[model samples]
Target: MAPHERACFYVQAQAPQEKLAFYFAVQSGGNFDIDYEVTNPAGGVVLDGQKERQGDFVFAARSAGEHAFCFSNTMSSFAEKMLDFDVTAEHETQADHPSRQNPLPNAAKQREQAAQSLSTIDEMASRIATGLTNFHRSLRHYHTRLHRNMDTVRSTESRVFWFAVMEVAFITGVVGAQIMAIQTLFNTSGKARV
Candidate 1:
């Protein structure tokens, strides 16, 4: 991203009441922060943030249409940013379940019970899946942070080591020059006295 530049992406919701999940992280670059905004189908701001390194958001769609997710690097003057993001729309419609499509007249009661049980199980599974995804993303984010910190530490150590070496060399040169100057002065003074 360039200075004062904004990037926008669109995700379509197939139906009203659909669930939309947005996740983004700044992987590298200046300050590891960026501004983000999410707008609904009617162009109303649903969520907005500034100078955020990572965010995970889930919201229900108010209408069936395209939603906009925009990211801004306007705070960065000369550095470009690297980001990882995901947008997902989850819909729970009757059409998605095969058992709901057709029912037998004879076993209507039993089928209904089974369908309800399946729906419960399906909902639980979805929740678990979402949890795992978030955990994995968090692990990745931490790993990146640790790696960057280690690099900075190593760079500082190298600089300190070199500076110490240079200081020792400078001190040694000054001491040698002082000793030579003292010897020359003593010899000249002794010759004048003799």
Candidate 2:
């Protein structure tokens, strides 16, 4: 992004009352700070921050439509920003659990209870899977950053080492040239005019 430029994105929620979560960070840029805001479909600002490096927010969607998320570099005079962000929407299911059964026969009640138990187990497993996915993503992101940093450090070290070697060689050459010139002058002066 350029100075005073704005970058915006929109995410659409299919249903009302859906859970929308946003996480973002200024990973690298001229400055690690940016201005950001998230607005609902009604154009009302739901979340905002100024000069912030990172943010995490979870809010319920009031309506089914597009939500706008924006980042601005207006605060920076000539600095661009690199941002990493994620927006996740989870829709709550309206399925009725079998446990909410009315009065029934013994066998019927037992079957209903078993179905409810299975539903509960399935929900738990789904949650665990989602958690694991997020964890793995975070780990991969951090690992990439670590490797990039190490590469930069290694490249800088190599450049510095080569620069020092070149400097020493140049200095030695200059000293040798000066010594030779001095010796030549002395020998010429010591010889008698012939």
Candidate 3:
């Protein structure tokens, strides 16, 4: 984004009290920081910050509607910013317990409990898998940036070294020429006096 500009992206939450999770970062920017704000559909601020490089947040939805996540590069006058973000909405997925005329048998209750436990475990596993994938992706991006920076450093070093070598060679040639000129002048003067 250009300097002093703000961009907003929104995700809709259909059900009230759903979970909203966001991961945001200024992947490349003037100073690796930018202004950000998260607002609910009613224009209530959920989160706000300035000069932040990254943030991971989870907020419970109070109202069901579009939630806006905004990023601003307003502090910088001449620099552009690049942002990366992911927003996820998780709704209640578990079924409510059914009303029954009689108490469930012990075995059935145990089986139901087991199923719930398994569901919870599955949800946790899925979250873990997603986290790991995002982590690896971030790692790869950093690795590529590191390699590019190293290449730039190497190029600069090589240029500086060659420039220094050329400067020394030029100075040596000039000094030699001066010495030769002085010797020739002295010889001519001595011969003329003789």
The C-alpha local distance difference test score for the whole of candidate 1 amounts to 0.87
User: After superposition, which runs of candidate 1 have C-alpha atoms over 4 Å from their true positions?
Assistant: 94-124, 143-194
TM-score of 2: 0.65
RMSD of each: 3.7, 4.6, 5.4
54-106: candidate 3 lDDT, tens digit per residue? 77788889999999999888899998877767888987666543422244676
- For TM-score, the strongest prediction is 1
Q: Write the per-residue lDDT of candidate 1 for residues 73-188, one digit (tens) a residue.
A: 99888878778788989876644576765789998888899899999998899899889987987886787677557656777899999999999999999999999998987878
State the lDDT of candidate 2 residue by residue for 30-149, as single tens digits.
547889999999999989999987777789999999999999999899777777788888777756655555636767868777877878898898999889968966875685466546
Which candidate number would show the highest lDDT if scored against the true structure?
A: 1
Worst lDDT 10-window in candidate 2: 94-103
C-alpha-based local distance difference test score of model 3: 0.81
> What's the TM-score of each model vs. the native?
0.70, 0.65, 0.61
